[model samples]
Target: MAAVDDQTPRAQLTASPDGRVTIPAPLRRAAGIEPGRRLVAYVEDGRVVLEEWEHLLRRVQRRVIAATSGHSGSAADALIADRRAEAAHEDVSADATLAGRGAHGPDPA
Candidate 1:
């Protein structure tokens, strides 16, 4: 086991020739990674990052399914629809107010 200091950036250890790298207990505990935990590895800025793979994939798949089924619309679409309805209501109210303006006499103090 490698000794990691407080300032150590999660020691970058190499896998054995057999393609196996033991995860440091401290790092695993901090990341909530444990035995039977699935992980995804990717390189960013020349360094490899390991993340909880199954959880991320499940979240992405759920979003994709929702979008494909049209059960969930994007935030922008919902906002635009709401704004359009509000504008339509405002226009109707303005038209009504203008048409009734002459019927109401000058504002009585």
Candidate 2:
């Protein structure tokens, strides 16, 4: 809290002996961090940052959508199609292996 950086918002906070810090209610409300929300903590540039997991996911989703929008297909759809193709390849390979084994006895070992 303590205005860790001028670029970030300031909040008054306290850390207990067990190394747990409580984010004040006002700060939480301002940041839209609600109760029962999941979070991730990380250190960057020698600063600790706590962020809601949903927020991170949304930001990444936006980035992905923006990155893929120029393409003629949806990212999720493309991913599903790719996975299906991979599975089909695996099925073909397995069938070929089984057929080969049936057509020819085990190789001399």
Please list the C-alpha lDDT of all candidates, in the order they appear: 0.60, 0.61
Q: What are the clashing pairs of model 1? A: none
TM-score of each: 0.41, 0.47
Candidate 2: residue pairs that collide = none
Candidate 2 achieves a global lDDT of 0.61
91, model 1: CA deviation in Å? 47
Off by over 4 Å in 1: 1-9, 58-109
**Model 1 Cα lDDT, one tens digit per residue, 44-64:** 789666756556455555554
Superposed by TM-score, candidate 2 places the C-alpha of residue 41 at a distance from the truth, in angstroms, of 2.3
lDDT (Cα, 0-100) at 56 in candidate 1: 46
Q: Which model scores highest in lDDT? A: 2
